[model samples]
Target: MELRQLAVFVAVAEELSFTRAAARLSVVQSAVSAAVRTLERELGAELLIRSTHHVALSDAGRVLLPEARATLAAAQEARHAVEQQRGGLRGTIHLGILQVLRDHPVSAARVIAALHARHPGIAVEPRQAGSAVMADDVRHGRLDAAYLALPSQQAGLTLHGLSEEPMVFVCPPDHPLAGRAALTLADVAGEPFVDTPEHWGTRIFSDLAYSAAGLAREIRYEIGDLGGVAAFVQSGLGVAILPPGMIDPVASVTTVPLTDAPLFRISLAVPAGRPTGAVTRRLVETALELRDRTPTPAG
Candidate 1:
């Protein structure tokens, strides 16, 4: 019923622990519990199933979570609009960034710096995670927006294409496939490959590529960081398929063009069909501008 109550409920639903939610909101645990109880009484429905050790969203809670998020976003947008009219935007933008963008031209640091320079009153909180997890976070209202790689279309999120780079084949210099002028998925189908874990954007893209080509490849090494893939390949543990920017030139690995390479597409994802706050909009614009200024990586 009340905005404060809804805020408390959202925090508890997200953290799934009264103590953690109270800590996050900087409020006492009793206050958090009181707010949730008031909300439940007003709604005439149980929102969360609480136990001593765990809390899970009930069916009604799951149904109300997205609506609560939308309502909160709308309220924030209204406040931000009024704040902008008065002077400057003042709010926090929870941003999700990809782990593999450290070496890329559209660096997250650059984007954040630009946002800060433009809107000094706004605060940007950045969290690094794999693209899939970031996307999910954005959809669930945990993150205001995210810079991530999109392997495919995601529901409940709007993706603004930032950059697209073709994947390259990486292997040791002396490897058999290293001498090839170019390679295809079929060419590397039988070779041992090194890649990120299944949930990572790179792995999902690679898997989709192989699946589309009706091919299956063996993954001998699964590295978490894109930077580490080169090391695995340099040691002759296995080969890799990654965007050109991800391959370390200084490493002992060789990068060959992929004739049928899958494109690694980066995008800015935000929740679809909802109003975004001024801070979130400004951050999105900053990211897009930075992406435009940075030259695309050559295949």
Candidate 2:
């Protein structure tokens, strides 16, 4: 009935002698006999034929040997898997994020690759959605956690600021302000502007920068995606203030820093009261490490 009993049974069944099985198991011959006898009684079958000169399997012994061996093997494998999970990590980590990271291209792949390297059994599943929706899902237990630009104040969410990336203004290289050492938000006041949708987290930095500079907002157009906003500016349609992740398509656009704005913030979001397990914490930490290691784009 017990795994130990089955283990002894398999050893005795294979060796066909309690004396040899005891040597293999590092137990006394009498103890081995007692263990095998206990197994026989629990199974309600006589498992061996033994006399003064020899030992052999009974019909019931032959029938149960293979099954007993199989059971012990399976139990050992299950124990190993459980131990691995307890000591290292093994399971799927459901990760959620917003458009900025979802479209970042290397972001998810990098984090997943790191998980694979460090713990092959830890599977990373990346999901993308709006920031508010990201929070809602984590709060409801739909997702384990997320890398999102945190809102100013949100109940039921714990935000950890991993790092901050300063926002920059993008314009055609030939634009008048592109040559400045550093520009203020007021300097771009009247320039036709293209930026992320006002609902986006980065928009808070943009709006706050404009308000502090006392510039009337004059946006030529609003785009939901930063890539699109970058492209629009490269084509000379307008200027845009964007985060670093949006700098990929800059054949013609010039990015200049806003010396007086709050840049942008990076934070991890998890349900305040939900328990964060080991795998969940690793995924979040991996995300933050990925951002910190991002390569500076070539000019």
* The candidate that achieves the highest lDDT relative to the unseen native structure: 1
* Candidate No. with top TM-score: 1
Query: What lDDT is reached at residue 111 by model 2?
Result: 70
lDDT of 1 by residue, 1-299 (tens): 88999999998988788997898788999999999999999999999998889999999999998798788878988898898889888899888987753457777778888888878889889898888888878875678899888764789899988788999888899999778898888988899988998878888889999999999899988988877888888888899998876666678888888888999988889888667777888988988888888877743
Per-candidate Cα RMSD to the true structure, in Å, reads 3.0, 19.5
Stretches > 4 Å off in candidate 2: 1-88, 98-106, 151-153, 212-214, 288-299
In candidate 2, residue 109 scores what lDDT? 65
| TM per prediction | 0.86, 0.61
**lDDT (tens digit, per residue) of candidate 2 on 1-299:** 88888778767766677787787678888988888889889889999898886778999998887687567546655654685868756767678855552346335566778878887877877887656667766764456777666545568778865556677878999999899888877878889988766556666678777777677868888887767877788889999877777465545688887787555665677767435666667777776677667743322
User: Candidate 1 — which pairs collide?
Assistant: none
Error of 2 at 71 (Å): 32
Clashes of 2: 0
